[model samples]
Target: MFLRIFNRCASTATASRPTSFTFPQRLNRSPTAILESLNSCVQTDGGNPAYIFMDDPFLIPTSGHEKRQLALSKAS
Candidate 1:
């Protein structure tokens, strides 16, 4: 579902074509855009504490949420 939406949005940007995607302008390529990009990559913990702590640095409400929220709020 997410990949489909992402592809649609991305293709819309490139639909004009021949201009080429540019860094800092392209979605998910900027430093500030990374948090939004990573939000979609989160996976379920499956009841593993170690997996929650070690394997998921970007897990919301565990590690990256506070910092990501702060950064995004500050940007706005």
Candidate 2:
């Protein structure tokens, strides 16, 4: 169920652009934590293949520091 929705949303995403998707529940985790989890999920050896196949990475910034970091990363 979750995968279907996520796949549909992810399919429309492009690697060269920034897109946003909102989940049902608010996330309580930190941006770094979320990124780490996603990073692990995309790994080839021990990861969710569904995420590995995503065209672009997901970025969820939940704090000012994370927002700034994301902006800087994109700028460079």
TM-scores for every predicted model: 0.22, 0.24
Candidate 1, residues 1-76: lDDT per residue as tens digits?
9999999999998887676666675454667677866777887676654422443455434456765665566569
Lowest summed-lDDT stretch of 10 residues in model 2? Answer: 47-56
Model 1 CA deviation exceeding 4 Å by range = 17-76
lDDT of 2 by residue, 1-76 (tens): 9999998778767554657777798768876997898888884765333332343456555467766776677669
Worst 10 residues of 1 by lDDT: 48-57
Which segments of candidate 2 are over 4 A away from where they belong? 1-58
- Alpha-carbon lDDT of model 1: 0.63
Per-prediction tally of clashes: 0, 0
TM-score, cand. 1? 0.22
